[model samples]
Target chain A: MPAAIETRNLTKQWGDLKAVDKLDLVVNEGECYAFLGRNGSGKSTTARMLLDFIRPTGGSSELLGGSGSDPDIRARVGYLPGDLNLPRTMTGRDAFNYFGGLRPSGESDVRDSLVERFGLDPTRPVRELSTGNRRKVGLILAFMNNPELLILDEPTSGLDPVLQEEFRDLLAERKADGATIWLTSHVMAEVARVADRVGLINEGKLVKELTFEELRHQATTEITFGFAEPVPPSAFEDVTSVAAVTQDGVDLVLSLNGPVGAVLKRAAELDAIRVETEQNDLDTIFIQLLSGEEQS
Target chain B: MSATLSVYRRWIRDRRLSTVSWTLGIVVIIVATAAFYPSLGSTTASIADGSDSGEAMSSLLGLSSGIDPSTPLGYLWISLYANIVPWTLMALGVALGTAAIASDEDTGALEYLLSGPVTRTQVAFARFAAAVSVLLLVSFLSGLSMVLSLPFFDLTESVTTTAPDGSSTTAPGATVGDIATGTFSSFAVALGLTGIAFLIGAATGRKGITLGGASAVGIGGYVLYTLSSMTSSLDFLTWLSPWRWYVDDVMLINGLTWDVTLPFITATLCLLIGWQAFLHRDLQSS
Candidate 1:
């Protein structure tokens, strides 16, 4: 089957600034893809283009195998805008009901389930809800309809830790049921936990695309070994490219990039005991990628 | 089609309280004016009777009271046109109609609505229909007030008499039916103004600017028409104003002519243009 969401060289320009530039993305069915980017990095712009909220200036996008602004395409897609400003006069329950009524085959208990799961107060007016509560309401509205494709921008924002974990699980369940999810976030840990494949965007361009396993391989490992005797600076030569090494008396800390076997052999040759190795998380990989450092 | 109608129903539910308040406010103004100016009827009668004093007063009040005081239908016509109809009704219509669409967009609720299965045409038409309904309701209620009060003034009686040239005078009572027809003329005028305001709101996407700019142009047109009517040098300018076609005294006392058709036609054209603009413009997120 065709990809659930595809953009062909999609470009959006606001005056001289290119908000999104010639972005070509294909999100496959039943896969959870995370778009990782820093502030002003075109993630939100890309999401908006996918949803047809704003017309692309130089290229085109398709949602659910249909071209721009197609009604059938929109019917199968659910979107949560980066800026969620609901009407202040309406209650959270009313807003959800209004959107729910628009769906052709919406679940009857979706709203109630969401309200109960999130512990959201249905009686409170939207204006009275806190920012986090408002974000919860927006999440419920976007996810409750069980749309075929879900495009969420910064989905976990303003949510507490507990709700964030619940949201991640909900996304996983949706993916298991053959739904496509296109998520954008600056939170690397969350992206690492949920995203099967990740794309890093910078200055309106997709700079890197890697699967979770590839990302783990590219990450560095921390090695700490206590030497029986003081070792020379060249004692670990030809073992690995150490990013940083700090020695406190006899215990030595080394941040190394490469196979763990190399580091282990080098430590054994140095007569070191009690050596520990821990893999670097997604946060380290993100910082290294965005900072113009290549991962070998 | 059902979805389109649902949007209109939603709009009515959202704005019912505000509509009632606006209509009530306009009705209060009309009633107060009618109560304070009871001689307004006598002045209309004198002008209809064609007496010298009646003629002077009719000129001063900018009215034409027909040919006989005993049958003062002309005065009733003047009251309906000038005081009861267009002035208050049209202002309310423009304010309420412009707010109906532009306010939703301004506050970002429009995106939520448009993102649904409803098309842009459905939204535009539904909003237009709802606004027009509110305008008609206000006009009808105000007209009803005037109709119910006619018997209190004993102005519902018909009479017959002998003329100076031996001709018989058969004058008819100013029935509720006549009053309704007269009110409808003003309704047509107000409807046109409401359409113009709706067009402005759609084009600009700003409720305040649309309401303010339309109100200025509307009130300015009325002022220009009144000023031009008083001056021989500016008489030609009166034809350019929308208010010229809606003048209460002229429509009620002199009766509407082919000249009144221009405003209604212009209004329909403007509404079509507005709908087209709404359909093509990108939905604003606001």
Candidate 2:
């Protein structure tokens, strides 16, 4: 079987800027691939190109073994844009019916069930809804088709903690049911929960690709030590455990991936005022990647 | 149901308020204007006798030949149907056509719609067709208002025409055929402008450009036609204006002419070019 999503040298250029530059990616069938990128990193642009909303300047992309412009292929895919804007007069139910009616036997039962699950008021016009509620409507529309593939941009952006958890659970269920999902998100924790693999993109280029196991096994720790006097970040540079260091006022925050004992001993020897340690997860790795720090 | 048809239905449903308001407003204008026909009586004929100011007034109002202002059809032409009704219908068309693609695209709603199982071709055709249908409906209502008031205005009376050479002739008064054909010609002119708006909207996907550009072209065309009518040196420019095809013969009084088909032909050409441009261009992000 062909990969659910594939791209070869997919690029988009606007005058002097390359929004997506020579990107090559593939998501196998039933795989949950998360694209991690910062704001204006071309993640949304890639999603738009994949759906044929914006034509790529060069190279190509395929969705579900067919071109993005193919209506037949599109019918089997569910998409949610990052910024969801509906007509002001259309109620949630009206939107559901309008978009759903376009598909061949669009899943109404699924739509209704998802609406109930998300606690969406289908009777209310979308313009009156809050940002989070509008996101709920977008989510319901994406999941309504029971599609074979899903392309979601910032899927859980405005959801509260409880609803975010519900969304993650729903995503896991969909994954287990053998659907391929490709999503872009700034929320590292959400990606850590549901993503099987992740690719980090920076300035329109893929910087790193890591599996869930590799990401989890990072096991990096953040240690913050306050000195009586200001200390430079280079003070603990030779320690094998120290991956990166940043100074905040009189405090030195060290990212330790190996063993923290050596760094702790050194800090103690230096007569630090206070030393605090916390486990640093995927978010730390993301920041490190974007900030030009070398990964261990 | 066909996807194109479904889109058409949805678009029409989306603009139901606009269609209702324009259609009702036109009907009211036509009725109110027709009510004055009885009171004006012979004064209408005196204006058509062509005094220096009267001729200038007729030209400015787009009351050209084949219309005798003494009769009901000619009265409506000089009073409201010729310029007012057509311009109002054209305004509706321009508004609808501009919103058809550009408004949806700018609002970010069209991107979501395209994500469905529909194609860009379907969207383009559906929107254009829906705008045309609503325009025709407005024109139909305008004609119906005049037809319903025909008996009230005693429009069945024959019109006596006095030629420039001092020759007199009699012409039959307004009939249902005249009303139907006149409405069709009016609709054709509006549709032509609507098509231009659709083309601009599809090509650019910007509401401001679509509305402003289409209005400029329409108003410019009218200005050119009016100036050409007054100056023989600029008369050739009339061929390019829908106003010429519309008012040159004054359809309600003169009966139908071959010029009625020109707008549809031009509109189809615009649609083809626009549909292709829209299908290939990148959708503007909201």
Candidate 3:
């Protein structure tokens, strides 16, 4: 079977600035792929290209094994843009009826369930809704059709913590039902909860691609080893999984990835007097990765 | 329903309030103008009966060769139906056309709409149809109000004509059909002007440009025609203005002419060009 979403050398340029550049990406069927990037890192641009909202300056993209511009193919895909704006006078119910009427197969029960899940008031006009409520409306519309693929950008942006949790649960449920979700987010916690694989984009280029397992085993530990005799930080340089080492007096701090077996053996060889290890969370590691503070 | 039809229905529903208000507003203007017919009828009749004064007044009021301001058709044309009614409709038309694509795009609502199963082509055509439909509805209501008030204004009496060739004749007064045809002319002219706005909106997706451009064209056309009516040197430029074709024949008194078809043709051409431009250009998302 073909990938749910695929791009080959996909590039978009506005004059000299490349919004998205030679991005070769694939989201396999039933996979939850998190596109991690900072603001203006081409995440929304890529999503727009996939939806055919803007044409790629070079190369192409496909959604559900068909051209993104094809209406029939778009029908099977649900999209939540970075910014959601609805007609001001339209009530939530009005939007549901109007957009639902356009669907090839109308499913009112599903729409209702989503509304209920999100605690959305169907009678309120869009203009009267708060930012979070507007996001709820956007989410409900995106999930109403039970689409095969969901492309969401900053999906949980305005939601409270409680609603964010609910959104994660809803995403998990959709993933369990074999839906392919491609979401772009700068929030590390949210991505950690739902992402099976993550591709980090920086300045319109894919910098790193890591699976959940790889992320779990990423360079996240900072080890502090002290010795009676002063030792250089390079003493542990040859050790596997050691990302970076910093020396202070007779003490050295090492950022490690794998088990501490090799580091311990080396420590014993160096007759280390004291040793301490602190496990770092994914966010810290992600920051270090982005800041180029961690050694390759 | 298809996405195109659904969009059309939603658009109509959204504009329902504005439609009612514009239609009612035009009605009020018609009623207020018609109330003057009772008092102004005799004064206008004397003017029509006096050849020299009538010639100067006809030219000033944009009246045709055979039209006499004393008659119901002539009074309505010079006083309300010709300039006031069409200009009011023109305001509504420019507004509707500007909002059709450009305003929605400016608000970012259009991006959300297109994200659905609807295509850009569907949106372009559906929005144009919806705007045009509202123009027609408002125009029809305006015409109906004029027709209904004819009896109250005592304008159903037959008219007497004085020819420059030393002859006189009598013709039936303005009928409901004449009022309907007159309103149709206004609708057509407004539609043509609105079509220009719609085309600009579709091509540029800028509300300000659409409104300003269409208004400039409408007002500019009228100015050109008026100036051309006085100066023969600028008369050729009147062809560029639908106002020329509109008031030249005085459809309410002279009945429908081939000139009435000009607005429809212009509107169709503008719509086609707008649609093609919209399809090719990138949507200006906010």
Q: In terms of TM-score, which candidate is strongest?
A: 2
**Model 3 C-alpha lDDT per residue in residues B1-286, reported as the tens digit of each score:** 6788888889888888888999889999998888888789657766555466543345546565555677777788888866899999999999999988999888888888887788989998999999999999999889889889988887787777677998987656668898988899889889998899899999999998898999999999988877776678888888998877777788877788998889888889999999999988777767
User: How well docked is model 1, in DockQ terms?
Assistant: 0.28
Task: Give the clashing pairs for model 3.
Answer: none
TM-score for every candidate vs. truth? 0.81, 0.92, 0.88
Candidate 3 has a DockQ of 0.60
Candidates arranged by TM-score, highest first: 2, 3, 1
Predicted structure 1, TM vs. truth: 0.81
**Each prediction's whole-model lDDT (CA):** 0.74, 0.87, 0.86
Top DockQ prediction, candidate number: 2
TM-scores for chain A over all candidates:
0.90, 0.87, 0.85
Looking at model 1, how many pairs of residues clash? Answer: 6
Residues A59-128, model 1: lDDT tens digits = 8888778854665677677777665666556788877766777667567597688889899998888778
Give residue A165's error in model 2 in angstroms: 2.1
User: Residue B28 error for model 3, in Å?
Assistant: 0.9
RMSD of each: 5.4, 2.9, 4.1
